[model samples]
Target: MSMRDQAVVVGASGIVGQAVLRAFAETPGWDAVGVSRRLPVNVPLHARHVSVDLTDRDACASVFGAMKDATHLVYAAVNEKPGLVAGWVDRDQMQLNLGMLRNVLEPLQANARGLRHVTLMQGGKAYGIHLDPNLAVPARERWPRHPHDNFYWLQEDYLRERQPHSGWHWTVLRPRLVFGDGLGSNMNPLPAIGVYAALQKARGLPLCYPGGPPRVYQAVDADLIGRACVWAARSIEARNEIFNLANGDEFVWQNVWPVIADAFGMAVGEPQQQHLAETMPPLEAQWAKIVGQHGLQAPPRFREFVGQGFAYADFQLNTGKTGPQPPSLVSTIKIRKAGFTDCMDTEDMLRRWIQRYQELRWLPPRDG
Candidate 1:
């Protein structure tokens, strides 16, 4: 019905979803529509957003049914459980995720007759990281599916079963600790770390490392992942393939403390382990005071702005761990060989995204 490629980015408000929506909208000859339960507050490229609860099949039909021009789909929507990690193995959680994807896909497949490609988001958990911390370093796309109960398996299986009949090809991306432009996401570390830095600065304290042991970890910028989605959509080499992605760099939390501390205009304080899930959420009053003091536009409620981010931070940051953790690495050689050769410097990424939050007035500016 439309002249250009219509990219419907499901979960458009999420970190990766937003990035994908922005990339497609900004690219030549593409129109991107954001579909999510709630419209994103800050849409890149000023793209249009539609509110659709993916869990509601009838609702999905009502909305996606009207999007007959949709030519590409980026299925980044996810239903993470409370507490974040435990739900990875929960049976109901797996089925619910599969159902959500089915709801989105069935309606689209029925209406969007021209749909040519689909992208699904997966992460390190696919390698059994939640069940066993010592997963093989630099996990690859060609390896056997790790023996684990994950919602990723459910959704991938569904896609594989349905794709042969649907006239669409799909690509699955497994990224390491995805980071960038998300608010209150169940797994994003940006808001949690930003608030932590802000609260520390407000109290006249240096930035303290609240995480436990120092483990080398890798992260993929949401923007890179977004661009990758765009590339995957058009690249024949990416059809029906899976790729592991990252920034092609690694960092230790303790080592990066200085960069974050300097950004907050604070000195490095003594390292301490406080379960952010336990300590950070209970400080809503304190966060509100900081918000008022800085005149930040952040949501007054901690949960509204941070979601389960603090808990996810503890998990990703290795908070309370007594020793070094085996690095959770994944290979991007496949994606690069497939023609999407994109990378970002992790430290520069940290600097820029932190600055982006400040520029949005959602977090305090750097100290002078």
Candidate 2:
């Protein structure tokens, strides 16, 4: 579809959602409508904003009912509840995602008019991770579901089952640890670390590395993810397919630690040889002091941060082999061949994020 058509974006207020809206608005021939629980704070006047809770079916139906000429529907909403088990973490997250899909699809299936593509945001968990040692690396779309994967499986199953029957085209994007712009973003771990580290530095405390740093980790900028989503929505080759999204670079946490230190203005001290739990208390105390000094809100306790941070940091995904894998990294040749050629400078992205946090007062000044 040409850029002149209308695109309806669900979860437009979120980091990724907002990025999608920004990207779509810049392209020619596209007018953007955003639907979310609340209107985004600083959207352009040309863009339309609608408020609706995805869990409320009637509200969702009302929102979809108004979009008669929409050419593309992008679902960037996700259901996430930290500290909850797989079964307990709001089946509604998956349900709301599937519900949004079905809500939009029913209209397309009935009218079969303007809908060109429906893109849903999923992540590495859909392909499973090292959580189960039994699983192998470089997980492909064809890999069997891991036993513990409940939420992603349900969503994937619904999409797979419904795509063929629905008239609208469909694509799924699996992005790894998206980091950029929205550091305090609910899903990104780096922001949490950055905030904590910044607070610690402000308090003149040491920034500690937990669990000897994760064995493997990679991240993509939110803008890059947005571009990929838009590209997938427009490209015929992207339909009915799943593609991995990352910065096309991979490194262990050790490689990233120096960057983190530099961002927080901390010395690159010797790596602490300790487990995550033992290292978190002092770091949390340091964070507390920094938060107090800056009058910023205190984050969740050290244990909570450690628990969540470990889960995110320790997980890794193979972003399919296609691009020039930098030295000492695995090949990313498969994804690059699929017309996905976006790369981001992780260090620059981190620096900008740190600056943003400071500007927003989420992080304290160095002397605070």
Q: Compare the candidates by lDDT and give the number of the best one.
A: 1
Reference-based TM-score of each model:
0.98, 0.78
Q: Kindly list the per-residue Cα lDDT of model 2 for residues 313-341, writing each as its tens digit.
A: 32321112233322222233555787879
TM-score of 2: 0.78
Q: What C-alpha lDDT values do all the predictions have?
A: 0.86, 0.63
Q: Report how far residue 12 has shifted in candidate 2, in Å.
A: 2.2
- How large is the C-alpha RMSD of every model relative to the true structure? 1.2, 5.9
lDDT tens digits by residue: candidate 1, 107-190: 888888699999999988888877788888778888999987888989999989999978889999988888787777787899
- Give candidate 2 misplaced runs (Cα > 4 Å): 1-3, 41-46, 82-97, 103-113, 142-149, 165-167, 269-332, 365-368
